[model samples]
Target: MCGGEQGCIETVKAALQGGVACIQLRAPGWKKRRLLELANALLALTRPAKVPFLLDDEVDVALACGADGVHVGQRDLPVQTVRDLMGPGALIGLSASNSAQIQQADVAAADYLGVGPVFATQTKTDAAPVLSPEGLATLKALTEKPIVAIGGINHANIGVVAATGVSAAAVVSAICGQPNPLASTQQLAAAWQAGVK
Candidate 1:
């Protein structure tokens, strides 16, 4: 969800109202003060909803805001280091886009694996090569940790991604810039439920 702070907050509020299972703050370019402010605002919403709030690649802000945990990519801090800093109870997520990455991942330290670009994506310009649904499932077979499929996931394809047995689908454009994030989330949630069935 990349946008001005207020826009991002509103989108998050709508998604939360629409029952998103978790919230991850991913503001890579924002200054620390601004990021902290957004994290705190989001926490105010997520804590009450009982939804886990995770900061993406921003361990400092996450720790300062007392987020539920942090999600790190391959190049970010190592899983064990994050676990050590955030403590054992913190929920750590690691991104794994392919077999080698998955094979090399510190699975025991990460609470879950964010696997994808399930299709091509524009959200993260530097995202790894696309991992089609087949690739995602192949990786899934290698780990028992929960899988959250990310990158280019939207309403049209979420059902297919969900059908692959991923624990959850992480979307950016599908909800963030939609005319009605709440409705978009509701529809996608329904699609995911149907696919999982």
Candidate 2:
């Protein structure tokens, strides 16, 4: 659900089958109309499965597909503005790079926060510096918003991230570009569960 490039749909299907709680479509390379089409199709696929669908940086498409949420970066739509547009009940998430930003964020308007790149990642070439474990620990103490770790996350290191007490991990290339997406997704999901008592 991260990459709208080739193999994205299949990757999403595999993750859903492997028990991802939510999926956010975050590709910005596609045209608005095309993204809308993909959002609609993903909504159809996820609606019956009871999985929540989220959109990144595109409120119109999110609204068009009746998506469960929309993730807006700090530079993108303001959370308050998005809250106004989506109304109550629709989830709105914000991207945060550190504890200061997390604390400063009007989290009252957001349902969650995308906290990363926990490790350096190529998924977003312009991503800020990677947040070390200590940084994650700091952020964890700052807020109760379900902190969803993203960037450079995978089966190999997801458990460590989850152990920081974050609620979820948002994956991209790890599942999207894998030779065995379903197995990888299962492994990552299990890693997340391993963090629990």
Candidate 3:
């Protein structure tokens, strides 16, 4: 999701400064060399900040860049396969959109579960149906693994997301294309905190 009006690195730096808990690099169509370059640069920032950096669907690039791990979708590599490749120390994340997917997921292998399009999202053209806060809560009850709510999360609705007792929220457009990613991230973080309270 780089190559926006503002560069991805700068946006990441701002989000880190704004207290983003983790960073997932999710550039879908870029070439491997370019993806590796961005991953390395992002690692430079995330590593020093003690933030976990993850690549989306690019295990080779992640390994090359020494990223913390990779996030895989259902159609991507299997969770056990990813764990086997990344080994025990690497943090693996899996996306499961509904109860059936969640039940079928190999929770033992993944460090966490990314569940959503909790609302309508334009970020992913093929994103799942909207889960809403209630759907997220229902999905949460289905698994013991930490849930990171994804899709359509923004400052306006992040409070309800946080109030769902999810372990985290994965935001894209809210910060990525914004005028001030740092300020936007700060507001989202504050909203998440307020929602948690």
lDDT of 1 by residue, 107-175 (tens): 679999999889998878898989899889999999888999998888888999989988999988899
**Tens-digit per-residue lDDT, 92-138, candidate 2:** 89999976779874777999899988988887988989987668878
Relative to the true structure, candidate 1 reaches a TM of 0.96
TM values, all candidates:
0.96, 0.94, 0.97
TM-score comparison, 2 vs 3, better candidate: 3
Looking at model 3, which ten-residue stretch has the lowest summed lDDT? 1-10
Query: Ten-residue segment with the worst summed lDDT in candidate 2?
Result: 1-10
Question: Would you list the C-alpha lDDT of every candidate in the order shown?
Answer: 0.90, 0.85, 0.91
Off by over 4 Å in 3: 1-6
Residue pairs with colliding backbones in model 2 are none
Residue lDDT tens for model 3, 1-197: 54542398899999999999999988787899988888888898999999999999999998898999989999998989988889899999999999998888476789999999999999999998998999999999999999999999999999999999999999999998798999999999999999995
**Order the candidates by lDDT, highest first — what do you get?**
3, 1, 2
lDDT of 2: 0.85
Which candidate do you rate higher for lDDT, 1 or 3?
3
Error (Å) of candidate 2 at residue 138 is 0.8
| Superposed model 2: Cα runs more than 4 Å off | 1-6
